[model samples]
Target chain A: MADQYTIHFGILGCANIARKVSRAIKLAPNCTLSAIGSRSIEKASKFAKENEYPDSIKVYGSYDAVLDDPDVDAVYIPLPTSLHVKWAVLAAEKKKHVLLEKPVALNLKDLDIILEACENNGVQYMDATMWMHHPRTTQMRGFLSDAHRFGQLKAVHSVFSYLGGDDFLKNDIRVQPDLDALGALGDVGWYCIRAILWANDYEMPKAVTAWREPEYNEAGVILSCGASLRFEDGKQASFYCSFLSNLTMDISALGTRGNLRVHDFVIPFQENLGPFYVTANSGWVGMSIGCDPPPTEHLIKTDLPQEALMVMEFSKLVKNIKVNGVAPERKWTSISRKTQVVVDAVIASIGKGFVPIEIN
Target chain B: MADQYTIHFGILGCANIARKVSRAIKLAPNCTLSAIGSRSIEKASKFAKENEYPDSIKVYGSYDAVLDDPDVDAVYIPLPTSLHVKWAVLAAEKKKHVLLEKPVALNLKDLDIILEACENNGVQYMDATMWMHHPRTTQMRGFLSDAHRFGQLKAVHSVFSYLGGDDFLKNDIRVQPDLDALGALGDVGWYCIRAILWANDYEMPKAVTAWREPEYNEAGVILSCGASLRFEDGKQASFYCSFLSNLTMDISALGTRGNLRVHDFVIPFQENLGPFYVTANSGWVGMSIGCDPPPTEHLIKTDLPQEALMVMEFSKLVKNIKVNGVAPERKWTSISRKTQVVVDAVIASIGKGFVPIEIN
Candidate 1:
């Protein structure tokens, strides 16, 4: 047998999201949850027990212990946005391939420090944007890439919002200025920006203008905001992300020949099926009294949840590097960095009194 | 019975849209087709026969014949937008009620002329924005107005677009500089602007800025354009209209408490059933992995098409004015004027190189 049969993962911080990824790690065929760490060992052990984790996994008091352990080949960091830079760099330097949570370091400069460490040590790095690994996303990409079906994309609109109640508004780490200073723009807005960039085939916008009068908390953290992204090719995109509105995750992309809509984009309404509606080459009939045909619904079914798929993809990359002696994949790291650059630009534009800020 | 049991409609021009309105006039309980007129007698006769107008209805070679006929109580003018002021004003001066097709005139100057003639003659005037009279629209409005379900209006985004193909881009009346001069902004964007105003309880926006570098035809007529509207209350609305993209008509309104989306707002996919999806007070669970409640799809069934409902409403108003000796409804005329003012502001903004134009 090889040095390690399964890619073992050590998770940093027993954050709420860690529980879901813990299950995903167990579900992924070639991934195993080896150890978990929190500031308090009891909390980590309690999380494992509550989530019905097997007794084989180890629990530690400090994140350093998990990164220090020789048996841990990779680390999943779901720590608050503030701690991402310190721990992600340390994990990568320790030769552990890292799957870090997003708003991956608040800004590109801090994220580049971690990326540099990963490059120096030769460790795979991927952000925890689970939906990117979903098979339905692949299908949507196919439609977008087809010239006959979608033609030249003219516009894209994305929205990710959730109604945060009194308790969440007052106490969640997401709203804390120190923990996640970008606030809603960092949390849900990350998805909106990523979706826009994804639809544009990763070509960043020329400029971004944040919409006016954003709601904010007492600490001046953004509660809700929107922005318009201008592309050089004459196509356009806009997005709104809020902690003040009802939950709606939607992406509407319009091309010359077609348009596509996904109402429940971030998370599907059902566990196994993700549905998107697309219409191509639609022409008017009956003298525009009614549309000739309705948008056709395409349903994509997945055996494993998107998070598990994400874990599997990350594990495959780690396996290729650890087993086949291949270099770490830079595509994931590059996309994550580009997404953060746009996010930073949006924040800067808002700070400049909602003026359009040129993206570098 | 009353002196004139039914409001007799005289339709000027044999435009393709007139066929749909012809059916609407026949279907409306209080309305009847009385006269049909065109530039040529042969065309008018062909239209009357093709649409199956009753034998008692008169067919005329010139538009003056319809206005001259004392039996024709009202006139429905479906002519080129550039010609709206002349025909609509003439119809009103002849003491015939007017139902004008949209993009009411080239600008407010022309529209006000028609309005003045109607007021001077004590005749009812209404723009033919068919969706305004849809029962489904009323139901959706109720939801938008509810504080518990949908709270204070925050933002609205509307889109109405259709791929015009080679022929439409080359030769359609919409692309002609002197015909529908505003092009897509006038023909399709009128609906989008009206929708934003409708959602805001008809409150006028404070400022409007056209989106960057609108696509235009060779004659300098807009093929597509988008705009951002700023309201005094910090609310924002945006709209995109195009003759260069696929068929899509959507109105997505966001509020403090909830949000609503109607895919086909201008015209429903199904004539009898108008389905709108709305989500109110949605909360999250499983650490953002899932949303607790999915949006509910509300299907509103109407016995008569939206156009017919529009005709029925117009006939009822005309009946009250002519037979009951009541005053004309100021509400319809006022809303139409407000809509036209916004349309003019959008065009002005585009003309000023996409600068923010203040609304009067």
Candidate 2:
């Protein structure tokens, strides 16, 4: 008999990001990679062989085969952003826990349908934003919560950009309006928006305004964009995402008494240790030449990589429903929905001539 | 007879920032403090003594006395923004070069009067934005100008913030509407705006929009604010400044092929060596877990402090005009004017209910 605590995961595509999640599922202590489905059986078998999956792991030519397999307790959907609703809801309807990719859907409406299906089927649902599970994230939150250290939130700034080479600009699905229809706003901006919301503890901004006309491809898909968000309590946030700039990921959160900055927020240079800069109660040096007590670095270490931690967390939620007869956890779905809501508002704000868009 | 080589400096006030500039004058090879002026002669004497001015330097009770002194070749005005036009124009009318503090005036109209006086009087006018003279600044410019390394500029973001203590918020001249009335927008945002323009090679943005309602004091003085700027070429810039947040200064500039970030952009953490991060042609690691060949730190050292370099450069221009019979450099005055124009637009945008203000 299989281990009673182990939750089996079925992967639904062979996207590049799926390989990273696959490794995470294999590394997660409570999770087992049971199945992988691709359109071609040869491709699925080759992927399984190349990744060195266990002999018992099954490879299917079509995703439906994996969804029908009762042994596969959970499904990881890493298809294009446009296909998330269809694949995620279908997996939920088939009684499988769903781990959908970021840009959970093209918009909030589809994401809600996927989430509703998961809730109706009593299955766990989480968007694959691995940074949320990083130990450093929790430590940063601790600092932000410390009244003496950070005080009240004042502003948040985030950036995510990477230079898309000639081939990527010409042929990538992200540049194609029909596939990753949200483009960079959905692909990279998803993380930047999530970061702003996370910094504010998921408190929706009262209003969001896009920063004028963003650079778009010939197909009218956004390749670069920015937004400024205003919170109810006079707090503020701004973010930029682009496919035409160098790989630069940053999150800068400023509070009344302290500030925090992370250069590689989306993905750390070193997986084991993540570093961030923070300054508290800093003041000017004599004559205002420089600041006293320069910002110091705080490094957080993790036993399991953040992606593995994400997998373990999702598996625990799934195990609760399977072995303990508890209802599906709503927290994960709630956070994913909030992220999608902001993504939709950003798009809508862009659509309406970059005017301010109310969150609700 | 006087050597006629060194530019004789006459300081218009005893403000705290004046002490730093005074020291820079003393350190600059081509500049020397000749006269010190304050409303109170006793205060001028005490300032000269506390700052350890040379015995030959003169102290006067009235700022008019400094402008009237024939031996003083230039005036370093660190007075409140409200006094900039009055003192700068008067200094120019006296054939004295003006090195005025930033937010050069309350508005562009005031700045134009100052600039016109400098132009009409044939006196070199330069703002005391010292970072523009840092050797590291030149090095960063080199990278930005390199087509292979940086390519076309895409976006710029700047932040300059400090937690002004209780005493500062209560009694500082910056908080007084009749004094430095622009408050943090003029005090800190000036540098942020200048950095944005500098990163974009001095090309003014086509339009500017203030970010919602800014935090203001009871005196109707802005304490914190932000703005979004859009250029004619689809380039974007955004900046934030605050007297309420922690001491954090940053500039993140992105380009098509590369990106650059300066943690301490306004003021270097160290006086001798300034460090900045840059990445060129950086790409994703396998499965997008991380970026490869991460941003590298480049450090540039200067023999003299950036402020001292500013003094020397300004003095050199004054020497060229006085001794070499060259016309006053239009470059310095042009940059100062552009900076003021943007400041005016940002203020106008805020006043007009945060609507987009076109920059002509």
The regions of model 2 sitting more than 4 angstroms off are none
lDDT of each: 0.89, 0.90
Candidate 1 colliding pairs, count: 0
TM-scores for all candidates?
Answer: 0.96, 0.98
CAPRI category for model 2: medium
Model 2 lDDT, residue A189, Cα: 95
The digit string of per-residue lDDT tens for model 2 on B1-360 reads 236698999999999999999989888988899999999999999999999887899999999999999999999999989999889999999999999987789998999999999999999999999999999999999999989888989999999999887788868999889988889999999999999999999999999999997998888898999999999778999999999998888999998888888988888878787889898887777776767777789999888889999999999999999999999989988888899899999999999999999987
Relative to the real complex, the DockQ score for model 1 comes to 0.63
Candidate 1's displacement at residue B178, Å, is 0.6
Model 1 off-target regions past 4 Å?
A: A1-3, B1-3
Candidates' chain A TM-scores: 0.98, 0.98
lDDT of 2 at A100: 90
lDDT of 2 by residue, A16-50 (tens): 78889999998899989999999899999988988
